[model samples]
Target: MKQRNGSIQQSKLKQAEKLLQRYEMDTWLILTREGSDPSMPLLIGVRSVHQAAIFIRQDGQHLALTSVSDKGNYEGTGLFSKVVVYEDSMEEVFQELFQELSPAKLALNFSASDHLCDGLTQGLFLWLEDVIGAESLSSLEISSEKMLKELRSLKTEQEIERIQQAVDLTTDIYDAVFSQMACGMTEIEIGQLFVEEMKKRDVCNGLGNPYDPPLVCAVRNGLAHRKPSHYQTRPGDIVIIDFSLKYQDYVSDIARTCYMLKPGEEAPPEDIQRAFDTAIEAITQSIYELVPGKKGFEVDQVGRKVIEAAGYPTIRHSVGHQVGRATHDGGTILGPQRIPPRPEVEGVIQPGEVYAVEPTVIQDDGLPCILVEENVLVTNDAPIILSKRQTELVTIKKNQVI
Candidate 1:
């Protein structure tokens, strides 16, 4: 794709070339059949019923081998530089072509540690060996994962703008939720309101396949991620409205907390205030430490120490996770604080990455859970918090006009 003017295709190809050089990959291969490889949607933006292989070379060349039927699909996008079509025998043609563009090493979409990277099916793996022969197979490595994580984590300017729009929409949806929320409203009712508002703006889930429902959990003492239920939200209840929106093929994971107050109440109870403050502090510390060259766990430690020092139970989840096309995006996560056995990715943090910083605290009065999650993008300097920070708790006034 030789288009200028900051097109999405330009961004994708630009990143692909950088990734090739960054990882020193000779050729990156993506093979799929019947859409078995979920990564195709992110990599190529389309799937094929017939078998196909897209090759990205270190020399900034993109080549595709596909059935005649799928040729137009890729060619239409202008993503690949060359297209080789096969009518009867794909194996015969691919093997001959593979010899001509001989690469020292080939990266396949397979990784044992990460499921998102493991898109190559067993049938395809076997088929590849049969088609390419043992010599070509000897040069194959499942290093696409390393490049994939890099590709997904490094957001282009266009992609960052799309993500910001999604976050803005999600923020607006939460604002509507707090505005209309009232005492004695069932969780299902409020959850429905969220869905209705998002639908009005045509916001979809961040994940593409199999639609996801909005999360509106009303819990008194503990925090949980669950579907909205029939449980009616009562006065003084702390509600966690976890919501995300898909805008321009990007998604946002934003969680906002609201407290239902009795009529004429001016401020929240001291216990609730303390919980919100502590959670905010955790988020603040994590954001401060979110810089390149630091380990992910080091950032996690800052958040966990602040929460635990305040005499609250540490969250049972990671301090933060990468957020992008998917809610739980790929690569280096801000590993859990105060949790045993760290993940390998906790070791490093990179610039041009985005993460969702979420921390939960059980209210001091033993009545509610206060959790605040925000999206942030790591820069060469300080991390940029994408969503508007929830500085004050949302108040629900019963029968009060907005």
Candidate 2:
């Protein structure tokens, strides 16, 4: 465990060094209390209590000011060169330290667009003002969005391995589901089967709502971001299953849409087929355009254009999103249009980042909706599809064997 923590710190430090050099930052400051910051587990490998601040200089110097109780976990990794601890109040000690290493620019973990970076709460920010003093706080910069996005979205080699394991598990679970699915099953019934199978297979459960997995949205009943219900699934109904499992702390979030065919049917209806093809093409085009240096909107445009060109109503949501620790892992967005305060949706996609391309076109011919979401890893040349890409609309026929 100690070695694993050390390795993660080393990897983050290496990346931080490069980011500092590229941006000419003076120091990166991360403030958190009670594990409010998402970077806490990744940086220190433990939940934190009491207020704490981690300072990383552009020259690779790491310093931490934390409560005595939390000092050991942060110090155990040997990642912090200097560890300052206090029993009661941190104001006196913290002010002195701030005076000594007065950074010209300080990166705070707050963003208007990304929630992962926006971990610092308003109440805590006010308390920190007293801890560091008004003068020192004035020197800070709200430029941590770019830094956090680059660090969080970009995966290391080991992280990719863990993610791949989760992805494969999800694919296997898909097989389990398709094998057992039949016509006349309720959405909740299928969901129950999924829960049982995941337990039997011992797959890790996802966060939020606790009892339920991610979601299993059936045709005409639910769309993107909606949960499943007791709605009965019928023959020729478009069924979309969206679920994920956790391997260690990594997550695999993949979704697939298929047609529930009647007896002796091999393929879905014509309209459904065309919609699936358009979504797949959009995904392919988006992947091909996802090389480094391209803006987020540019990659999203590839999918958006393909769908709109094919005469389908444009999807209101973005083309895709970054997937990692969380399903919508924040910052690195792959979307053409976004509402205000998320203006940074046009940021460039960097190599080593992972994303989920989900583009959906509704099938209005009394058929189900068509949405295909696949995972991808951004590379220098072409983005690599991470999960097993769906090539066709799966025909779930009666009495079909796996």
Clashing residue pairs in all predictions, respectively, total: 1, 0
lDDT of 1 at 314: 74
Error of 1 at 321 (Å): 0.8
**Distance from true position, residue 240, model 1, in Å?**
0.5
Locate the minimum summed-lDDT window of 10 residues in model 1.
1-10
1 Cα displacement, candidate 1 (Å): 16
Cα-based TM-score, every candidate: 0.91, 0.92
Candidate 1 similarity to native, TM-score = 0.91
- Summarize candidate 2's per-residue lDDT along 203-320 as a digit string, tens digits: 6655564347557767667565656687887777888888777766677778888788866666777877888898888888888888888888887888889989999888688888
Candidate 1 regions with alpha-carbon error over 4 angstroms: 1-6, 134-136, 207-212, 337-344, 362-366
Span of ten consecutive residues with least summed lDDT in model 2: 205-214
lDDT (tens digit, per residue) of candidate 1 on 1-402: 223322665577678778788777778888898888867766677679799988888887788899999888878767777989998768988887788888778888887666777889988888888887766686566468777877778888877888899999989888776777787888888878877787788877664332455777776633566767788877778888777788877889888888878666777789888888999999998899999988877888888888899988877777888887788877787876335654434647887788899877754444657778999998998899999999888877775413
